[model samples]
Target chain A: MSNLLTYISVNDGKIKRSSLEVLSRCNEIAEKNGKTSSAIVISDDCSTIVENLKSYGPSVIYTIEDPIFKNHLNTPLLKALTLAMSEINPDVMAFASTEGSKDILGALAANRNAAALADVSEFDWTGDAVTAKRPVMASKIISSVETKGSPVILTVRSGSYDTVEKSGESKVQSIPFTFDKNELKLTLKEIISATGDKVDLSEAETVIAAGRGVKDEEGRKLIDELAAVLNAGIGASRALTESGDYDPSLQIGQTGKVVSPQLYIAVGISGAIQHVAGMANSKVIVAINKDPDAPIFEIADYGLVGDLYKILPPFIDELKKIKG
Target chain B: MKFYVCIKQVPDVNAPLQIKEGELIQDANRNILNAYDASAVEEALVLKEAHGGEIEVVLIGPDKASETIRKALAMGADSGSHILTEGSEEFDSFSYAKILAEFFKDKEYQYIFCGKQSQDTDSGLTGSMLAEFLDLPYATNAVGLQLEGENLIVKRQGDTGQEMIELPAPSLVTCSNDMNDPRIPSLKGIMQSKRKPVNTIAVSDLKNGLTNGSIKTSVVGYEEKPKREPGKKYEGEPDEIAKEVAQLLDSAENVI
Candidate 1:
């Protein structure tokens, strides 16, 4: 009964999609165990975020405002997180499987000696513990993890669940927290944030990436035009960037920027391992390559084989017509 | 300065893979150490050659993966350690990190290197996870690294280009192939590797919930891409290519 409370992070009452997914899954657990769920968002800038959190059907939303907790990541956030976890005393503490948030969660989970799952997409609450489906051994295999602990720490992947719908507001409360600053170990001086890029590939709705198959500067012109038409961001394979045909920011692959867009257009890229590592998470992958056997086709939802010399122009034309 | 290069063998990027009977199937192609990790090894060797000391390669995987170990040793690492495990394939990041964390609990190595991500999983989660587990500083995708007193003056490749970050000694770094061409195994080095140390470890030694339940995300299933019709090639006709391209772009692809 006391173990049903769940603490979640929210923004502007607008909870991050992954958080909603975690809450959605956690809600299922609460129902099964006859427990209650309460989510939390710690931020001083929380304007309408509390309203958004209310829509998700949390029994309570811990709204704590502090300049230190304003930023979503880094700054040894575990201090604030640990405080929230301890105060809420939830049966499970959850976070999104993200670079920054997960790092904080990792520390908290270790401190609490709770079972931690990385990048779990599915969840099930059996009698004793929870089971989740996670990619293991470098994404070559899928493994099932069974976790047991009062506060099971879970990090759900982004885009794993449907949008959080309004289940009506049950309760919302502003919880107070002032974590120690000296203990904050990881000091992120700067995020190396991207500016002047106009669009970020990771958050873009549409991405048009070029590969080595781009015949010449001609290919570049076509991609730019397509991006402009679709209002999509421009991305590139290492080959094009390595050849100095495009900016490194346009590069997508291993050691490159990871992107997950609604429409991912990979033009002239062979989809090497390094390149695939970046864009493999895209929802709809469309490949345009000259070689029919190019590896890009392996994960692509739609693949077009032919000389970029022949295919790209037609494809761009088709897109233009659709917009017109 | 003695260097430590952590190398991993992974499936070929272009290898065709499928899931059958709850297992993965892939083409039988010659396995190679990851390009990025290979670059790390090469960078280490250059350090070894420049400032003489042993460069040992460490591999933590199943026995079959020792081939990569031999390859790293052959490629120029002075010696190797293949911590062979019977069922390490089932190990999670925590499990894998625990093994390294427990094994190197007291061992001191000035520099530790790994690839940004393994080609097979491309998770790129381990080294950073290891750094967290070992309580060490970590820098990913370094283009170049130089030792400066008790710290490493390194230029790591970020999401964009090279970034300089200075971290104290005994830090973990993953090299991306942004700079320095990787080296192929030489005949002399390959021959000499036969006499180098290649130790193995039992999988059960570092046991403590080698199993993971950390929720991140999982691949629901393997999907095969559909076939496509090939497009025509453009010769030296720029005007004609542009016009035809423009028409096709307008009709099917949609850019200009």
Candidate 2:
């Protein structure tokens, strides 16, 4: 029996980086436990995805290519995954902490009467049980937890685990598509991107965040230009969103979405403590604020103390040249 | 129609965290209901206002959680059920869902609701897990919800965009922040909430006895994140700084 199993999620015919992270984490857990790791991908066509997944190094890769999965609804995918897991019966199962993944993982755990941890930022297998750590109280306190029972389910927080290179080959196994479609109680009518087909802030590699310093619509337009050049998701601090310059949906603070991207550039932001709590885990932080005493500079990898209006145009131009 | 909403009390996000004796201490300031749960309560109220229905808010927490439930009651929830428990720090999503399912299996409700996620654990697992435990279809991160005939249509925020999905009646949904503006309780509503029936159930009354050992998950303690040291700071011409920033992001960071 495989000791570790990871559910690899694919969107728009591509595997998300966070899914690979969960796979990498499973490999780590498997190695520590001296057992083999397995992976499962539910997609319409997983040939390319399975091929790409090899770099993460699982002992076996199982693909259930069913037309029913095209809808992106949870029940069909859950049924497929639950069935596969019932047969594999791995000691541990890991899922990426996305909306879809969380929905299915929770139910799957209940179905199997297994212990489940959600959005675990830190996890370790202690030979007898699995231990996990997650942030609580608005990321102020890190809560440590331990789980009991075989086949413990875990939802790994996105961007928390580092993705590593695979050391060996993995065997590909295509599982047969078998599910009663009539049992699906949910229907996916449509999926429309909110940002005009732009990447979501949580999944973006680069994020351009605005604060109160970007006072008006003109300033916001400049921020958008830079975001477009970088292909970055646009984020706003509570101050900007509250002032009606941006939507509350774009707010990033203690009360809003927490994002950990490869690069987070704070434009004209003072870096309130609440704002920093959300993106402090980012791999790199760049702060631009006229106020030299802005708290954002304290955690910034690169700090520029100057008027963002004068700085951003040149910054955008430089980025354009670099991209070209 | 009938609706069930899940509520949780969490530490105020605005309050400063204090570390005492190598352990995290709760802020003495007023504890507030989870923001998402407040949104969930508001969503349930909106539905109740449109269609004649009963709304009941459920919570599994310490005695103090009843205060959170009362807050929901003031917000127009008709009744409340508080499952009193101690040493619940280790109760994970699976165990928590099972308890709610056991409570709900006997009852017939048209819809179930919960916050997209709690600000405390931020796991966002309870609603979906409870639906699974109850053998019902569900959606998460829902910003918009409408009941059309026997089916429920919902708009959920996805990784890339918004998704429109329909689930059969007796389904579950989790409310995101922008679902609706939560209404402040009026003086009359607050007074009415005091008289609202808040049924309290002991943890042992549920299927699984409430204890850290009986639960599938257990907590150790909270640890603080390591502080980030200040990095390189540059102050000068925008053009020069921009060029240097681009070069460093490209060559050194490789994130450009």
> Best lDDT goes to which candidate?
2
True contacts kept of each: 0.05, 0.79
Q: Evaluated with TM-score, which candidate comes out highest?
A: 2
Per-residue alpha-carbon lDDT of candidate 1 for residues B33-136, written as tens digits (9 for 90 to 100):
88778988988888777767778888787878888888888888887877777762456444566677676676778778877667665445566666667776
TM-score of chain B of 1: 0.87
lDDT of 1 by residue, A1-324 (tens): 454444455432334566676777666767677766677777756657766666678777776668775554333355566666777777666665544454344445655545566566576664457677764433435555566555667767655565455485666666676656564533333333332445655456789998777767677888888788778888888777667676655567645665667678788788766676566666666777767788877777566656766665655665566567
Candidate 2 lDDT over residue span A1-324, tens digit each: 547888887877888778788888878878877877889988888889988988888999988998887757888878887888787888788888776786677778777767888878878884578998987766767888888777788887778887886879899988787767688788888877545556777778999999989988789999999999999999999877667687555778655667899899999889876788789899999999999888899999999989899889988998898899
Q: Place model 2 in a CAPRI quality band.
A: medium
Worst 10 residues of 1 chain A by lDDT: A186-195
Of candidate 2 chain A, the 10-residue stretch with the lowest lDDT total is A193-202
* lDDT score of residue A225 within candidate 1: 80
